[model samples]
Target: MFAEIKNIKSEKSDLRKFGITIGVILLVIAGFLFWKEKESFQIILAIGITLFIAGIVKPNILKP
Candidate 1:
């Protein structure tokens, strides 16, 4: 049981890292889109913001 709990903690830590990485990537893409002045910039920005928020709220949501 102790080992299982340890494994779960590690998994959650990994998921948090993964979530942050994904969020950063999305934000970067949004930044690029804004720099390029693309019509889809707002859409991507919104998605990026949502993902970033989701990453914070529940890192495991993006896990799979």
Candidate 2:
């Protein structure tokens, strides 16, 4: 009963979704900067890694 009220207090507390999105966005921006630096190898590596992790991560954006 009380759990419902507590859940509404903070959406970020969702276990199914962590701070992965924020990290991904930041990684993308950083990757872009690195790419402009002529670091194509690392750009591919970072993008591949970010996509791989994002694909497996289950983000909870709703109250189930």
Provide the overall lDDT of each model, using Cα atoms, as 2-decimal numbers. Answer: 0.73, 0.53
Q: lDDT per residue, candidate 2, 1-64, as tens digits?
A: 6878665633534432334544466577767767678566466557645544543464343333
Backbone clash count, each prediction separately: 0, 0
Candidate 2 residue 33 C-alpha distance from true site, Å: 0.3
> Quick one: best lDDT, which candidate?
1
Give the TM-scores of the predictions, in the order they appear. 0.65, 0.35
- Name the TM-score of candidate 2: 0.35
Candidate 2 minimal-lDDT segment of 10 residues = 9-18
State candidate 1's TM-score.
0.65
Candidate 2 displacement at residue 27 in angstroms: 0.5
Q: Report the lDDT tens digits of candidate 1 across residue range 1-64.
A: 8767655543666777766677778888888988988878787777777777776778777655
Q: What is the C-alpha RMSD of each candidate to the true structure, in Å?
A: 6.0, 8.0
RMSD of 1: 6.0
